[model samples]
Structure formats: structure tokens, C-alpha cells
Target: MIHWRVSLSWILVWSCSLLVGIAILCFGYFDNMLSHFQQLEPSKIEHVTQAAAKQETLPRLHSSKTGLALESQAQKEKVPNKATLTYKDFPSPVQGKILRGIGNCYLAAIESYMFHPGEDFLEPEGTVIRATHRGKVIFAGHDPLLGEKVVLDCSQGWIVTYGCLENIWVKTGENVEKQEMLGQVGFNPGAEGINDQPQLHYEVRHGNTIQNIETGGSNL
Candidate 1:
């Protein structure tokens, strides 16, 4: 019994010594860390804080730049081209009355003979004539039969012909938009005869097929 009691006392002493050593080690470690922090200058502290703030802001800056780049690319793609036009995107070529309708039973300008292939518009002399739709000019010159004429290939197998125009501004192979002025109304002496009235011979075609504007059969 005496031996067991002596062994217990020794064990208790060892445990107490271990706990005290651990406490001293913990206190010494904390004291060293505190001293290191206290030794730093104000400038060093400010620099460390600023560096941490910059690190936090970097991700947001990168995200904003990426977003702006994506938006710019989308805007570029959204830009329209000639192929963007639909068949019905055209407006009237001239603001005037339809002097001769489209069909076979129409008066020939130079003579009293019937059978006209296209519609005719009568306007005052020098009136502005505009493009029916966006297209590229394929012919811009005087035709012996049509007078001063401008022909445009408006895409989708469609073509527009403007006759009896003066002061032609667009040349062949030039791109034109809807309602853009191509020339001014001019006299068709053959059609007007002694009266000398200003007139525009407008025609729309789809793959060699002529379309009637009033009947909506012209493929627009």
C-alpha cells in the first residue's frame, strides 16, 4: 500500500509539471507574436492593408472588363447588312399617281397601242426619285428605249427599274438604301409626246417574273 501511494504521488507531480510547461510555452509564443506586430511602422501597416484591399477588388475589375468586351462583340454582330432586308421592306419609288397600271391592257407612251409590262408614275419635272429598297445598282445610264434608267438588284431574286430619271447620283455597283434618292424625274418624249409631261417608269421583278404592285403579286 505504501509503494502504491508513492507511485500515485509521482504520477501527479509529472502531470502538473507537463501542464505548467505547456502554459509557459503558450505564453511565450503569444508574447513573441504580439512583439512582432507592435514593431511594425505605420507606413508598413497601411501598405499591408492597401494590398489586402487591392486583392479583394481585382476579381470585380476583371469581371467588369470581361462584361464590356462581350457587350462590344454583341453590338458588332447586331449591325445590319444588305441581306437583312425583307421582301416587303421597300416603299414607293416616287410620290405620284399611277399614270399607267401594270398589265397588258395599258397605253404605250409613244403611241396609242396597248400592252405595257410595268407601271408608270406621272410627277412634276425634276421631282426626286428614291430607291424602292436597299440594293446594289447594276445599271445606271440611258437606255435607248427606257430613257434615263437606273436598275437595282435588290436581292432575294428581286430587281427594281426606275425609268425617265435625270441627275443620276448613284453609279453601277453602288449600294443604296430604301428611300435613298437616286435621281430626279425627267421627260420621256416618247411617252409624253407633245405634252412633255414628267414621268417615271417603275418596275419590280422576281427572277424574271414581273410583279404587280397593286395586286401584291410582285413579290414585294
Candidate 2:
């Protein structure tokens, strides 16, 4: 029994020593980690922070440049073109009453629905047709339905068309002044059967868009 008591005493002392050694090892490891963190230089930390800040601001810089470019383009669009005409520059092709106006319209003579793309002026055959605006005669040719047609490219982006003409005085590529005689009114027997009367079909266009003769042509 004395021998067992002695052995128990030794075991207890060994366990206590082992626990104390483990505690010392844990404390030493923590101290080393703390010292490593303390060794970081202030300048190095500042550099890292500045790099992170630059990364955050890079996208904002690009957005600002894009906004500036868009604003410049908008300003350019607001300014009018020097070659373009104004409201006062436009004039009528003939002095006559309006027979058929622009847009979808019904004609009694044709007895069918049609989309009239221009204004028809009631005029007698052989009435002198004049230029509506100062322009270059881009086309003076024959149309299948409009008979003899004349197209003028005026200042800016405006174009004028004179249809159902009996004759064309000006040739293609000829430059003409406003009110210059272009042709005489005629009947488009192929398409225009309205009342069998001679009339002038006038059309104005910008780009690919057809414009109204009453408002759009006047308010060039």
C-alpha cells in the first residue's frame, strides 16, 4: 500500500509539470504573433490604403469622362447647320387651290383608297410651274405614275419634288433660283384620274421622311 501511494504521488506531479509546460508554449506563440503585427511600418500601411483608394476611384474617373463626352455631343446637335434653310426660305410651287392634301385620302375619281404623299393644287393645263426654292435640279425625269417629275435639292437637307408636269425646262444638275419657271402643269393619266383636271403635285422631304406641304415645308 505504501508503494501504490508513492507511485500515485509521482504521477500527479508529472501531470502538473506537463500542463505548466503546455501553458508556457501557448503564451510564447501568442507573444511572437503580436510582435510580428507590431513590426509593420506606418509608411507601408499608408501605401496599401492609398492603393485600395485608387482602385475604388478608377471607375468614377471613367464615368466622368464619358459624361463630359456626351455633353459635348449634345451641344453640337443644338447648333443649326449653315447650309440649311429656314421658314422664310421656303415658297409655294404654284398659285392654286388645294385639291388633295397630304396623308391617306379618298379620291372620287379613282374610286379606291390611297395614301397621298403630297399636296395637289388645282391648276389648268399649260400653267407655268415655278421653282419653290433655290436649289440644284437633282432629277428631271419621267415617273411611271407622276408623269414628268422634277426633284430639287435645296439648301441644308431639304428636297422638293414637282410631279405631273407637262414639260421640264431645267435639265438634271441645273441650279435654279426661286420662282424660276420649271415646267407647265399636266395631268397624270396613269395615276391621277381625279376629275380629269390638270394639277400640280408638290412634295417636300427630309432624309427619308415625307413632310407636310402646308406646315413642314413652310416651317423649314
Candidate 3:
């Protein structure tokens, strides 16, 4: 009986060792896979390169007077609530390099879960951001993710937005002219995985759809 008990004890110890070995193997496999996924190649980022190419030939925008005239006509004609925005209805809000272009971004071989809704202009901190069209300030305040944000209502469902601002120059309900200073660009705290780079986020909305400001207009 003593010999039998010794044999049983040895079997139990071997079982525990085998289980621990298996756990270590599983952990190592997962760790390696995670690391591989985290180190995405820069060449895999197609959108960034494509946008960089497009920026070199971005079209010149019409003067501020054209934007004002378009706004006036839209208001006079009583355009529908879901007015379709033309390229001439807006202008570039900033003059800077496109940091992160509109759409998805790739990092560490991982694709972003959400599509970027606007263009990011890499400008210096405190660089002025202007309104792209004649409109009324609808929102001008701090946002949890965007920091300082400003939204302009251009009437007839057309709207323009500026984000990542350091200072806002206009107030809600105030009318702003095209090319008018709205605010200054600010540094992002990497809340959305972006580093502390100074940039202005610009978006043009016609009702619900967000327009591509690069192809849609200059500077964006």
C-alpha cells in the first residue's frame, strides 16, 4: 500500500507540471500574435499616401465674396431643408498639410474601427481657423473628445465645423462671414490615438452626409 501511494503522488505531480507547460505555451503564442499585429507597416497605410499625392494639386477655391453670394441666393430662393451643397458653397478653412486624411487610418497593421469623418490640417498651434462659408455660429465650446469645437449653420441644411481649436472667436447665434476667423488650432491629446500634434479638423455637412473637403475644395 505504501508503494501504491508513492506511485499516485508522482502521477499527481506530473499532471500539474504538464498543465503548467501547456499554459505557458498558450501565453507565448498569444503574446507573439499580439506583437505582430501591433507593428503595422507604414506602406500598408494607403490612404495617407494617396491623400498626400492629392494635396499637391488641390484646386484653388473661389474668393470669399462667392461664398457670400451663394449663401444669399440659397436663403432668398428658400432652398429645401436638405439642400445639396456644391463645391462653391464653401472655402478652405485653413492652409496646412493634411496630417490624417479623411477615412480610415492604419497603424501597427491595425485598421481603425471608425472612418474619419473630416480632414486634419497640420498647422502650428494658435494658427487661425476660419469659417468656410457665411453662416451663424450654432455651437462654440469645449467638447470631451474634440477639445474646442465650432459648428456653423449655413442655412438650408448646410453646415461647416471646425474642431481641435485652442480659442474660439465667435459666439453662438453670431453671424460669421466666409473666410472669417473662427478659432485657432490646438494640440490633440491623443484621445483618438492621435499624438499631440496641432491640427484643425474641418468638415462640411450637407444635411447628413459629410463631404470630402480635399476633393470638394481647397485647404479643407
Candidate 4:
């Protein structure tokens, strides 16, 4: 009986060890298979690269009044990260129908899904664009996609960006009062839509996150 009990204990121990060994082997095999399948080359990210390369280029926009191309450079705005600023409402930036709102939506013009972080308005060429809030101009220049762009830093923690325009009136470091004319909708050769209609793209941001222009209050 003693010998039988010892044999039974040994058999139980051996069985548990065998089961544990099998489990470890199975886990290792599955892990190796997953890693082998997940090891992808950079070409696997072809979708993003293809989309970027397929982006359409803009033709040189000739100023209607001067018939000459506008020349401007891009600027890097200095934001006060340490300052605690209050949020406020912005007046209408332009008079036009809203073509696009702030969110992810499909744009037929670009033939792709765009996560639009701002609002787009439709207006005729040369429509006046106004300052949403009284703020200092931090960036006023040309962008590859935004065209003639202007950025304003409202002391109350809000930063506004107006794009897809021409005939910019504000310059960097200039203080502009609310409702002041900053620019006008023009050729917008870098416009988002291929419809050939003049559109204004406006963005309001607090910190690094963009706020909805149509909404009354800030979500930041």
C-alpha cells in the first residue's frame, strides 16, 4: 500500500509536468506564428504613401487686380504654453453657407475620407473675410494647402486660423480688432474641393486641439 501510494504521487506529478510542458510549447508556437505574420515591411504602409503622392498640386494663383502671382513665406507662430487663458465666442468669420463642418466626412472633391478639423464655407471670389476675435496676428503667410493663411492668437487662450484665401491684409505681429478685414476669398488654387468654387477654411484651436467653429462654447 505504501509503495502503491508513492507510485500514484509520482504519476500525478509527472502528468502535471507533462501538461505544463505542452502548454509552454503551444504558447511558444502560437507566439512565433503571430510574430512571423506581423513582421511587415515599410511598403505595407503603401496606402498612406500612395494617398500623399496622389495629392493634387495647385496652379499658380494670379492676383486678379495685379495679374501677378502672390509671393509669401510660411511662418512658425510662437504660442504661450505657460499662460492660462480663458475661452470665448468668435463672431462669424465670413458670410456664406457652410460647406463642411468639423468632423470626419467624405469629401467628393478629394475622392477620399478626410478628418476635417475645421469648418469650410462657400463664397464667391473676393468675398471679404473678417477677424473672428480681437487678437494679434501670429502667422500671416502662404501655405502649400491653405493658400493665403492668417493666424491670430487671442489673449484668452484661443488661436484662430483662416485659410484658402487671397489678398491678405494683416501681417505678423500686428494687432487686429474683431471684425477687421484680414483677407478675402480668392482663387484658392490650393482649395480642398475641385468644384472651382471659392471656399474659406477656418479653424479655432485652444492649445493643440481644434475647437468647432459652429458650436457656441469651447470643448477644450
Candidate 5:
């Protein structure tokens, strides 16, 4: 009876060992499956991140292209306007003119000396001065040396200045037509009371650069 009980206890011990080995094998299989799933999850996340990065990059490239296209369109739309002044039929404002060919002859020297950009027409005092072209008055003011000055900005990059005037009749930014009276020529400040000869010191500028006005005037 003692030998039979000992054999039953050995059989129960063997059965428990077999169950524990099967449980260990099953646990190892489940752990391998979890590791493979984790590796696949990282690959999926990398693919999603690449797709999102492509989406963001494409929009930025498209926006840059659109901006360049808009800038090109703006460049194409720009156009230069017509010239307001013509080389014919413009009359001299002052009568009994003593400064004939003053713009043609003496302007080059005056420009060199004072770095002045325009011509000087020495006429009698109170000579009526006219606008050279149809334009807007940009400035109408007085300087101590220049006396009364009138500046007109015409079309096609042309600007005309009338200086050494006794009085100014126009205001700044006023639209002025061609041959309109700007002001009367006055005495030079240095020759005030010594000599009363009225003269109009005129200047023509092309986009802030002074040019010879004789090239544009009609010979009377």
C-alpha cells in the first residue's frame, strides 16, 4: 500500500510539470506576436508622417508660384502715358523780349556754374509769363533769392519751373492748362531798386534731371 501511494504522488507531480511547460510555450508565442505588431505600428506612423509632410510642402510651393505669377502680371500691366507738350505753336509770355535765344545760348554756362538745371530769360519787369504745357501746379511759393516761383509737373516726365516772379496767382496742386498765366516777371533780388528789368528764369526737368528747354520750344 505504501508503494502504490508513492507512485500516485509522482504521477501528479509529472502532470503539473507538463501543464507549466505548455503555459510557458503559449506565453512565448503571444509575446512574439506583440513585438511584431509594435514594429508594424512604427512603420504605419512613419508613412502617415511622410504623407502629412508632403501635403504641407505642396501648398507652400503652390503659394509661392501663385505669388510669382501675380508679380509678373503686375509688371505686364504697367504703361507709360502720353506727352503733354508738343514742339509747336507755344507762344512766349513776355512781350518786347530782350532775352531771345537765352535758353539756347546761356543755359549751358548757367547750368555749369550754379548747377542750375534750367534757362534764364532776362525780360523787362512785369512781363506776363505763361505755362509751357498743360499740367498741374506742384509748387507755388516764394524764396528770398528766387522771389515768386511756380513749378508745374506735366505729363511724360516733364517739369517746368518759372522763377523770379513778382507775384504768384496759382496755388499748389491746381490743374493748369497750356498758355495759362502763371505770374509776372520781377526784378532780381541783388538788383532790387538798382535795376528794375523783369526777367523770367525758366527751367525744364525730365524726371528730376534738368535738360535744355530749347530742344522743345518753337521758334517765333
Candidate 6:
């Protein structure tokens, strides 16, 4: 009976030991799986972040490239060449009789009547003014006397001015071509000052001096 009791106690102790070992193995396996999942979670998060960043940056890059291409094209179109162009070939915005010519440049001392400087084409109000040449816009804004005005500096000693405009379509330093719409003619309250008439005032200046539109063989 004593030997049987000792054998039974040893058997119970071995069983308990085997159960503890199995539990430890199972816990270790599950812990390893959890650690692997945590590592994969960070990798997935990084991938998603990188993808989002690319999506955000690509559209802006495309837009910038497109804008640069457009500006380059406009610049290319503004290059001017010297050619004999007539006013009949050129379209006029205002359709009226020639008003007054730039009579003379009055120097304080000298009273010599030089040839008229610029020709004045007087058209009724609301005429769509067009650009005379292909060039970059030098000025497009308002003045106290001119009202809304646009000036184009066609390279090679040609500059055109449109006055009494209702609105300006292009801004300063913009590229424009011949016959392009500069603006529309409007009534300037200060054109005649006292005798305000609804008319379009146009001028062409070469270098510092104004060119006579009539005698210059440039007609409206």
C-alpha cells in the first residue's frame, strides 16, 4: 500500500508539469504573432501616408507646368518683325471723320509749326478698339484725362494708344498681337472738358514723337 501511494503522487506531479509546459508554449506562440502584427501595422501606415502625399503634390506640379507652357507660347507670339503695313489693311475701332492732328510741338523759344504729330480718329461711342501690332502691353490702366487707356509698345519705334475706353481687357506687361481686342471706346467726360463728345481718341507715337496718322499714309 505504501509503494502504491508514492507511485500515485509521482504520476500527479508529472501530469501537472506537462500541463504547465503546454501552456507556456501556447502563450509564446500567440505573443510572437502579436509582435509580427504590430510591425506590419506600422509598415501599412507608412505606405498609406506616402501615397496620400503623392496624390496631393502631383496636381500642383501639373498645373505649374501648364502655366509655364502657356506663358512661353505667349512670349513667342509677341516677337515683332518690320513690315510695311497700311491702315486700310489695319482695322480701325472707331469709325468717324478725322478730328484734329497733332499740330506742332511748341517749344518755349521757337514757334516753328512742324508737321502734325498724331492723327485723331473720332468715332462714336462704344467702338471695340483693336491692337494695331503684335507686341507686349506696356500700359493698360486709367488716367485722369484719358479715362480708361491702353498703351502698346510695338518694338521698332511703334507705340499705339487707345483712350476713352470703357473697360480694359488686358493688364500691363501682357502679350498681345495685331488686331487683338484692347478694349471698348466710351465717352470721356473730360475729353473735351467743356465740349464733352462721345468719341474714341487714338494716337500712334514713334519713339518720343507722335506720328501723323493722315500724312504718315496710315488712314482709318
In the range 140-207, model 2's lDDT, one tens digit per residue, is 98987678989999967778899989878999999999899999998776675467778988888776
lDDT of 2 at 209: 66
lDDT of each: 0.80, 0.82, 0.77, 0.77, 0.69, 0.71
lDDT at 165, model 6 = 81
TM-score of each: 0.56, 0.56, 0.55, 0.55, 0.48, 0.50
Judged by whole-model lDDT over C-alpha atoms, candidate 6 comes out at 0.71
Can you tell me which runs of candidate 5 are displaced by over 4 Å?
A: 1-113, 191-196, 215-220
Q: Write the per-residue lDDT of candidate 5 for residues 124-171, one digit (tens) a residue.
A: 777778886788998999865456889888877767778888778899
Clashing pairs in 6: none
lDDT of 6 at 116: 38
Name model 3 segments beyond 4 Å from true. Answer: 1-85, 106-112, 217-220
Clashes of each: 1, 2, 2, 0, 2, 0
What is the overall TM-score of model 6 with all chains considered together?
A: 0.50
The number of the candidate with the highest lDDT is: 2
Model 5: residue 112 alpha-carbon error in angstroms: 12
Q: Candidate 1, residues 41-110: lDDT per residue as tens digits?
A: 9999999999999999999999999999999999999997645543355546666878776655523564
Clashing pairs in 3: 40-108, 40-109
lDDT of 4 by residue, 92-120 (tens): 57768988787777766556786776788
Ranking by TM-score: 2, 1, 3, 4, 6, 5
Q: Show model 6 residue runs off by greater than 4 Å.
A: 1-93, 104-117, 191-194, 217-220
| lDDT for each residue of candidate 6 in 1-220, tens digit (9 for 90 to 100) | 9999999999999999999999999999999998886778777979988999999999999999999999999998998755754443334455687655566433222334444344456666777788867778888888776678888877766777877788789999999988889888678775332146666667786666655555655322
Better of 2 and 4 by lDDT: 2
